[model samples]
Target: MNWTDSLEIAIALDEAHPDISPLTVGFVDLREMVMALAEFEDEAEKSGEKILEAIQMNWIEERE
Candidate 1:
């Protein structure tokens, strides 16, 4: 998924890191985790604070 697919990325992250809290993750680590996903296929340089925040928010929602 691309940088714009925040919800999808969040879902994948939630599944991949079931024990970790998205709220505690910093943008740097979060971006790394997202880039590591098997389904993720986007340029690392494309990610920014806003995209990361959206992914984090979606991940928080996914957990709830």
Candidate 2:
């Protein structure tokens, strides 16, 4: 999944880190986590703040 696959990334993140709070995640860490996901496949330099924010927002929604 790439930057556009925010919901998928969020789901993976939730499953991978169920103990963590999305609200406390920084963009840098979030990006790294996304890149670390086994299903993730994208250019590392293609991500930006907007993509990270979208991922974080979806992660928050997933927790709720």
TM-score, per-candidate, Cα-based? 0.98, 0.97
Worst 10 residues of 2 by lDDT: 1-10
The lDDT of model 1 is 0.97
What is the total number of backbone clashes in candidate 1? 0
Tens-digit lDDT track of model 2 for 1-64? 8889999999999999999999999999998999999999999899999999999999999999
Candidate 1 stretches with Cα past 4 Å from truth are none
Cα lDDT tens digits, model 1, 1-64, are 9999999999999999999999899999999999999999999999999999999999999999
Question: RMSD to native for every prediction?
Answer: 0.4, 0.5
lDDT of 2: 0.95
Among these predictions, the greatest lDDT belongs to 1
Per-residue error for 17 in candidate 2, Å, reads: 0.4
